[model samples]
Target chain A: MTIVSTADLLAILPELLVMAGGCLVLVLDPLTAKDRKDWLAYFSLAVLGAAFVVGYWFMGALTGSPRPAFSGLYVLDAYGAFWKLLLILVSGLVILLAKAHLKLEEIDLPEFYAFILLSLSGMMVMVSGTDLLVIYLGLELMSLSLYVMAGFKRYAPRSLEAAAKYFILGSFSSGILLYGISLLFGRTGSTTLAGIRDGIAGLPPGDPILLMAMGLLVVGFGFKVAAVPFHMWTPDVYEGSPTSVTAYMAVASKAASFAAFLRVFLEALGGIKESWRMLLVAVCIATMVLGNVVAIVQTNIKRMLAYSSIAHAGYALIGLVVADAAGTASVMLYLAIYAFMNLGAFAVVTMLRRGGLEGDEIDDFTGLARRNKWAALVMLLFMFSLAGIPPTAGFIAKFYIFMAAVGANMTGLAVIAVVFAAISAYFYLRVVMVMYMKEPGETAGTPGYDVRVVASPAAIAVLLVAALGVLILGVFPDPLIQAAQSAILPLK
Target chain B: MVPIFFAYFALVSIVAGLLTVSLRNPVHCGIALLALLGHVAGLFVLLHAEFVAVVQIIIYAGAILILYLFVLMLLNLKTEERYFHRRHAWYITGVGALTVELLMVLLASRFSGAKGPATVAAVEEIGNSTAIGILMFSDYLLPFEIVGVFLLGAIVGAIVLAKTPSPADLSGDER
Candidate 1:
């Protein structure tokens, strides 16, 4: 029997900080009057900032070595550190965005920030966990917080609908994931990834129970990352939820899920790659095609971004299919790049609202360049990056993934992904065109009345940060590439 | 003797599961779900997992089922004119496909085989709860703590979703 020591607690410092901070915010929320909720946002931001500091410090302390603490139920490594930093950064940015949006919408509830911080805590735990049970608990914690956050605007019927839809589907997918874990446990009599790996090391390929477990796990993960056939909830949830919450879900949740998915597959089930590779290939193809094709028809900006997000998930899967060190590194880099571009796009969407009208429709963005050139240009940069256009981070992300795929001799899948990516250009470019080329629609109260588009300074700051991150990543991606490479060194 | 009890519990659980789904009135369905949970607990007892059986009874049959009944009563749901909608055909088809897939996998696996990685030989000797407690405190400590955070999140989520908006909120006054 291995004894757990103080090292276990030290290894999980980031998660502990976030959880404690979240509880602090939750407790402080009710004590303060509902009107002065910005303090809560500031408090949550400070907490996330502390978590980031601790994460970086711990990452530096760990240096190059991977340590499995608490008897290998949790791991402290560059991989977890890399994603934790990203999650912490994303959560902080989302809080800033939420602060501005919630102020605008008159939502004074402090629980919003608390939920987001708790969800971030959950994601941190997930990316760091080595055991299936720990991962599942973290996932549930994240999902539950998100379900509430999605319906943060309880007065809005659409928000309520989004919450209900997300809750039911999310619970079902979690059930499927748990069932898969149970099946694997039954086969291996162990729930830790390392144990499962050791148990299945000598097994022949294509064991039916193993195959079923893999399929179920894939289905479960497919739902989490918004892959095809399992992505039916994405658009509705994205469209109906508050824009700030939508951005948080799109960026942070996907990163955490993919992080966990990579750890489980590339580490636990890497030996059974032959049995699962074909299923993933099919999923990748279908996700790219369906997500791209369906995105073109969306007039709602949030729904379009949701579909594009799904397509991006497929693009990320290409690297995982390659199943090499470079592939894992590229996927990490892609997610890092994606978190910026996707959140930036949603930030712009959140900015579009003013004077009690939602700017969700594509038509609302018509002639945005004429109204607000800076917003349009920022939106343009985000759209270009999302479409994987050259001189943008998205292009570099795609290039690395495709390069990894080609190196693995999966040229056919790479080509298919590229073709779908080109197809996606149509919809992403359509947003740019509407913002730049088309004329602004007439204001509602009067003919030819100009509506003032207002964005708080905080939201603009988020957009700027995201846009700058994209351009910097596009031009000088070597540092991030190196970071990503080291992050997945364990996979090699 | 165990096989006879197992068969009885399994059959009853299956029938109760079907009834839980088929019954039009939600209260009756809730009762069916209770029966199903009880039979599942019985099956757990037959497996010699006394701890699990007790948990199944206390958590599922006692608390969760009662909560379901309270929710059904609170919602004041009426009897539906039609049990299944036209669009529900896809639901049926989907469930059918899943069942078939599961059945094929189970058959192909040939379930009677050497048990893999029997890691818990001492479980019975130490007793189920005690062994679990030991593992929970040691190897499973991280997950156990994570479960605490998850429950905390759930509690916060429940309050956020269910609480009536305060008067300050209804007034829409900016801070």
Candidate 2:
């Protein structure tokens, strides 16, 4: 008998395409000349575009029921499709952003493109995984690529330090996650979500072993998503890595981790919602409080964005705590909007490099409006969206999340989140203030005086797409809302 | 005979594990780890998981331990006079107490999970290696394939980080 049928292969066509594309890039990296390396970035983008098209096509072909493949180790459904599409889009934008940034930083290597494709494939696998083991493997694949990419700048000591710290802490968390999976396997006799649910249904409420496993799982996922208490690595890693990588890690990795986190909890542990609900509520509150309060003190733009990303994770966790269809759909919408705005913000940061100077500090934005009106304008849009201001996608994202929380009778949590959201706006708006209000300082023999906003054609293209996405989504969110609503139908 | 073998393997492995961590000399630590791995493999063999036992010896004891030794030697790391500080007594005590508490809790609880289909009789009938091969090829195929991509990523990442750039590349105006 055949082990993998044709249907199974067809089911994973997008993943296959990405893996093939990654391998092709690796093979072609050394064969191609040095100056033509930019082609590799474009090639990787084409591959991501192809995978997105394929995934979207399959999404259209999705039936009412989720289709299981590989003995139910993986599944193809609208939820997975939605996440895959978002991840692909984020990865593509990151590549465009990276093309110029890498050249500017002098760390342009074709392997960078290969790692992106490989990691994107890992995230695709992660979102579609139906089994805990499959999810763990996918998580590892994604993280391993990121760990390497984090230290891509070998010449920079901070970059190396970031990679080492991320690698050590990330591996420790993965070990904890694997230990939890093993404990869960021992308790339930199965690693698949359906089997785990069935097994859990037969167990007594609050079984100590199962509770321990659940808590461990939460800790593991908390680290990956950069939730508070597990967010120590976020600032250092984000500030130290290449800006393009920071953007990708901040958006795509968090999105994929949340997708897997929701699936594992809602599908496998949905039987014991009361037990995990309070646990996540506490975590959510702590994450928001710490992420926002600490972000106010950050001077570096990357570090501030890192804390903002942490706060965003907390906001998303509110949906997980609600544990309903509306909660899930709100999270999907929030992350999609977050992707556009966050990537736009990082894309601007990526282009802020002048000769021999890294313009990553908030002071770099002093009189940015005077220097480049368009850059400042796009940055303002992103900051406004990030702060959840009106007529911005960020506002809509937060509104949905709070609405979902309130609908589930979680008014207390919603109120707490709104307070934190209001607190977060101060820092996001601070960027705009620095740009439009402050005068550019002229220093003797420092590149600070001539802080030129260097925008390559590729970077400009990214800015346009991201800005358009933020504006369009902010104004007309009906289509995405409907899509997110339909996407969560499988979970119910 | 079986109980005697099990006791010997389990006891030795636990002692070796402690030694691996406590030994000051790096080489001695490596040796202790090797002994720990060998004893764990012995325990696995006693459980009739011969395939896993062999793999444990080959992969962990043979490959990984050797790589550790190579790195240790290449780095020429000097053994420090003091590995732990006396001022950290309270910290150590807290950790030890927590570990003891965890052990007590684990020893008190009974494992009440349902058993799987892969009983001893089933494994013996199918043969351990063949059973594992079947599972890897069929039910675990997707994970198996994903591992390939994972390793490729790791290999490429290692190369990208470790590869020394030539002078011409480093002298570019981009830097």
DockQ for all candidate structures vs. native:
0.52, 0.56
lDDT tens digits by residue: candidate 2, A90-151: 99989988999988888888888899999999999999999999999999999999999999
Query: Candidate 1, after superposition: displacement of residue A109 in Å?
Result: 1.5
Candidate 1 residue pairs in clash (backbone atoms < 3 Å): none
lDDT of each: 0.87, 0.91
Residue runs of model 2 more than 4 Å from their true location after superposition:
A445-448, B1-15, B79-81, B172-175
Residue-wise C-alpha lDDT for candidate 1, range B63-109, written one tens digit per residue: 98899988888888785524677887888799889988878878877
DockQ winner among the candidates?
2
Count of clashes, each model: 0, 0
- lDDT tens digits, residue span A1-492, model 1: 566788888888888888999999988977887567788888988988888999988777765899989887888998899999999999999998988887666665788888998899889888988889989888989999999998887777888899999999999999999999988887766788988887677566777887788889998989999999899999999998889999999999999999999999988998898778899999999999999999999988999999999999999999888889989999999999999999999998887763465578777787888889998999999999999998999999999999999999999999999999999999999988877877776756431135446788888889889999999999999999988887784652
Q: Which 10 consecutive positions of candidate 1 chain B have the poorest summed lDDT?
A: B111-120
Best candidate, TM-score-wise?
Answer: 2
- State the displacement of the C-alpha of residue B137, model 1, in Å, after optimal TM-score superposition: 2.2
In model 1, the Cα lDDT at residue A429 comes to 94
Best by lDDT: 2
Q: What is the TM-score of chain B alone in each candidate?
A: 0.80, 0.86
Q: Using alpha carbons, what is the TM-score of model 1? A: 0.95
